[model samples]
Target: MKPLNWFRLVFSFIAVTAVCGFYLPGLAPVNFCEEDKITSDCQLHIRSRSLLQNEIQLFVNRLDSVESVLPYEYDVFDFCKDEKEKRSSENLGQVLFGERIETSPYKFKFRKDESCKKVCTKTYDTSNKKENVRLDFLKRGVELNYQHHWIVDNMPVTWCYAVEDGQNYCNPGFPIGCFVTFDGRSKDACVISSGFNKKNTYYLFNHVDITITYHSEESESWRGARLVSARLEPKSIKHNSQENSQSCDGPPMDIPKETTGILNVTYSYSVKFEEDAQEESGWKQVHGDVFRAPQSGMLLSVFLGQGTQIFIMTFITLSNRGALMTCAVVLWVLLGTPAGYVSARMYKSFGGEKWKTNVLLTALLCPGIVFADFFLMNLILWVEGSSAAVPFPTLVALLALWFGISVPLTFVGAYAGFKKTAIEVPVRTNQIPRQIPLQSFFTRPVPGIIMGGILPFGCIFIQLFFILNSIWSHQMYYMFGFLFLVFIILLITCSEATILLCYFHLCAEDYHWWWRSFLTSGFTAVYLFIYAIHYFFSKLQIQGAASTILYFGYTMIMVLIFFLFTGTIGFFACFWFVNKIYSVVKVD
Candidate 1:
């Protein structure tokens, strides 16, 4: 080896060592219970008590609203839990994620068949101007269909209700009542019951029956009881002053149209002890309903195909010694099977005639885009004499990977895909397409597609800041768990948001959903690119045209990958949703 090559090798060793030293701890296994006993870090443990005592915390938060875009804690409503309880100390990641772990007034300890033990009552005097102001603010949140995200023992308190299939759906959160507009706009929660159909009235849930179950271990080493789970049922009741806190089972609470009278809302809960073996069987009644796969088979295949390649690259980079580009090529070439299978099946299902074009596009289109961007960035690096530039030999190797290995593997996969029959849709397509009306500007496809990305972007923009810092500012990012979680959230958000917008468009009689679904979620990458530009100008101080070009070039590669990933999610989700919905409905 040349002298400069030897020096470069040594420098690379030193750099890798420094990176490992900083991040190895984060990757290493950790014991949340260090002293043979579970610590607070474990977030759950039971300490022995002389007298039987088990207190479970119930917390509520307002759900997603356009007003603030952030949920407010139920304690903000001032309906009452002990104020002296110390709030849980959050980890750095939790704090950054904006998680709130605090005690609420709705707490319950082990007791006999307790129905509605009033925790506290909030009396808002309509006559008092200050009291009325508080009441109005609370009403406004309810009017927006704000929900309650209740948590107990660090687990979401689920709301179990039956759906159309006679199967019960357990939602992580429930609405905090809803308003019935005078114009007959029945809000989401209002539609669940006819009692809520009363015009021009706001129904607030003023009572709760909480059930906290605990299990006691006989082992002398452990004295306290472990909480199994906590459940609550929110009820809206209209009780007169004579019936104050007397019955929780009474009729739903109706806050009259007139907000001038004194409004008293009572909150309460109960707790009990149970054997560990005595698990609640209600949640298990719908075992048949529990096993369901996510929709959009083809889209998932594309995503998994790309994800497998990325995962393989990360794994090899950490566990073995080889150039990153080489590993990516090898993994990607191997992943061609899935890619071809998915694409071929999807294309066939779409009634596409050109198999060769589908296969070629799948194998080359995205890679070509990435390579073009990378080559441009490399040229800038070469011009500036930057060490980051890829050498000519490496470029040749990359081409070998793409043409020699990746292309062949992709062809093999595509060949298999072409041999297989097209995937069958549950619903048959109609011979005549429905005519779509002229959509307004706001409801147009372009506007909806643009707006669809904002939410998924919002979910990830905070995490993106750190990722950008890692890449551009030369900061170490070791939060793989957080990153993985963000990835899942992004996937879910992208799918759901796309599905929602797709549904609205379909309801508007627009059948052009295939591309719309993909673009809607994919547009989030555009927002990401925009943010990168903002970050480059405002947050970064990169000097010189070469560096600027390189920054944007690499950013484009990332944006492209993200675009495909998010777009795949939306497409598949919407695809599955449309199939499912269309299959269930009778079509002429």
Candidate 2:
């Protein structure tokens, strides 16, 4: 081999070795139980703990929010528990989702009934200047409608309140308090109470009483009492005078909008345990409201519609490969209208005059490229006489799905989208564009786009390994929940990374963010393709050129879909972020 060829060979060898070394099973992160149970210091306590009966009581407090100016506790926010303690262990998914599982200070024996159990209390002296400042901070947090997210036993500790239609709703997170505007308009959460109707008043929840229920194991088959449920009610009480003391049961606590002097705020909570045969599932009452479609642009709605169909197709194909193609065809045909409508609507909003071109592109652009790639791969398979080659009739059916049903539905959607008025942009575009200055290599669009994908790629690469193993190595993929969780994480990571890069570019005076945002996140597929190549060479032992082509051809299809999915996520997120920031600013 030539000198350059030798260098390439050596580099490839090292790359493959490094990938294999890092991904080896023994080098993987230790499971939570494996690390704890196998260690001598933390011996297995499951057997010993089985003999004892215990009831789980969660002490919730110290609620804070990013948008808020104050951090309040159970007593301050009228949430459950009096004091806060250390949190418990969280799984990888929980940590990624920002779940806080705090440690409980109250662990009771099974069937134990306790009354007004005092955990802790905080009494502030308004005369103290430092205390006054702290109270002011707390007041501001409530005004912002910042929320508190409390967790118990790896699940959210919910706050149940009455809603419309004589129904009750449980919210996973509750606000510290709510602000009433100077014009006597109560905030969203404050509207639940008529006592909060006072003009320009701040209502702070100062106390919460929690009732916990457990089911004691009485039979020989089981030991100890397992917590069945926990419930809490918030009370906001106003203490008019020092002699009156703190009473949780009363009208809403009113804080002066402009307090410059002495302020007394008392915080306390009461907890009790009872053995009950009945069980209550927390946060279920709000299921209808929780799953409501979030506010987003038309494009996102269309994407979601299409994504739902695709998810269904994927789920079906997992168990029924015989009808995979047929199912996909039908789903595409049914889903095409929304896709086209979304594309046309977005295009029209961008002031595109070429309706026919936009509609055709929406229907054919991605699918055409994919089909062309597939055909080329099929030709190779045919030439090699491989069984993997899709039959000509199957190809015809696919085309029929594309041209007959999918195409017509797309046109219908496009017409519908065009009939509707284009979405209004928050900020007016300047007739004259701002000139971008000279940029460093790092700040340039291409490099930024490439770097934008790395974090998202990193987030999903570990999960991707298992997926690829299932696909090529024939291993079973049963962890759908974990896969779905990872999928969500991947989406979040891609959107965030792209948004960061887009912001940097905007700051650098780059106005051409339309396609850049998409490409920035879409580039993750390129890394995925590279990893696939690395895996094929290092991990797989397939010998034939035809099988290799088939592998790559199928892989390319996956890569393309992933590209669109991630690219769409990034584009919409950046679009929303840019519009929001620009709309808020006073720009000429």
Candidate 3:
């Protein structure tokens, strides 16, 4: 085991926070002013910019093959904004880099007051856009968003509705949602009336057509595009029933076509803002049905309302990084232990040995170390009374529940193991564990660790950026369903990669499967770190020590949990695969 081998893994995870975190010197800092300090004169003016972009989701071979919903995480503002300054789309360097110029056009700030402890808020309207993605409680739909900035030069603005898009502009993207802007002329027109509401802050998408289609391969347009019913979900608004059917009394749904080969579904969301906020003091918009995803609130809020499932599934949000995360985190934190134990027992039943080793690593070895930082980081948030810190009692309860459920499941798995057959891998193995022949560094576990990261990172780097933005950058993340799907994809990818390497090592007569599983899934933390570093240097510019320390401190917690999550996945997968093969073989 080379020293560099292990160090690289650890390095990749920490480097991002070290550089991109809030405390780094020479960068725009988040000026978070407490509500108390903000005076009646210091009005909180907000501008909401709504816009639309195109996306294409391609399915490769349909089954077993990975799919891609064209990674739309890139900055569309930079992608399209500079066409005016350069007089052409070809030269977009301004919007591409130092995006501060484009966003600075619309600014809002509160008066300085001393009631606050730390004014280092964050790049609130800084990065890509507001995070507003959510999954329907019925577990049937997804909503994605593109944020257009609604800003003014001085006072921070507020918006109750999702005023989206400058539809009348040159090269204007196809308008779907509401299309009201500050400036409709002079190409790069400035904002006169921003996207803000008196008391509401959620985006109000107008002209927003939310289309849901159901198609079967046997249908006419079913080749690539599915032909299904499309209608916008009914909102709390009363619009003319002319465009849609007589008016849906309840939630709108897309039903599958009668024909069948295999079903295909398509959901499209684009927007055009209605006439500017009622020139008076009322919420007004182009009267119509823009298909909404179901929830009009934050991700956590949406998911938290499990009791009001139907209600939460009615509209799209302004952003969704946190929403997407809600389901995944809930699933993992709740299921990690139980699954680990159940899978372990299944392996044992299949004629496996080393039960204690596998169970111990799953229950304690990984989780114990993973959570160590969480406890400490809570202290920072605790002392400051910052929201980042989870209450100690909550932490204790989480631990108690996680272990209470997972620990017993492990024993259940062990018992199940005692009742089942011995193990069997596809091929035979030597009597003793053979010494692996060393090749280049890449061929060893180090290479496997490095190689394992590419696909996982490719699939998740976009989402990861948003997550880091949420945690360190203080951006919201609420696309839990999408995130959950991605999480599933990543789990599959991690397991496959680990299995491929573990199989090779096993064939080579090396039997150190325990650590290898950890290394395989754990490798993702390395890539996460490296990306964090890249984002820090390439994307973020921070200032101050407290922010910096706080940044890394929190990041360590992310890395550690990821370590356990991925490691557990890999180990169980490899364990199951290994046992299936070893147990079924003839061992005379």
Which prediction has the highest lDDT against the true structure? 1
RMSD of 2: 21.8
Give the per-residue lDDT of model 2 (tens digit) for 41-92.
2234443433222334454435666664455544453223424556556569
lDDT for position 450 in model 1: 98
lDDT preference between candidates 1 and 3, better one: 1
Write the residue-wise lDDT of candidate 1 on 1-588 in tens digits. Answer: 854356468769977985675433223321112233434533343333222234444655435565467767665655565677556666798677666666677655444455666666689999999888878877877787676777765567876666897998777776677788888777766777787767888888766555555554442134445555656666677654554536656677766567778888766554443445663232122122211222443443444345334444444443443464566567666676667766776766655667787777777777888888888888888888888888999999889877887777777877887788876554445454444567767668899999999999999999999989988889987765566557657877998999998877765656667678888998999999999999999999889767787888898889887777778778778878876654433221
Where does the lowest 10-residue lDDT sum fall in candidate 1? 283-292
Ranking by lDDT: 1, 2, 3
Backbone collisions counted per model? 9, 4, 95
lDDT per prediction?
Answer: 0.67, 0.65, 0.40
Positional deviation of residue 350's Cα in model 3 after best superposition, in angstroms: 11
Show the colliding residue pairs in model 2. 78-205, 86-103, 87-102, 87-103
Candidate 1, overall lDDT?
Answer: 0.67
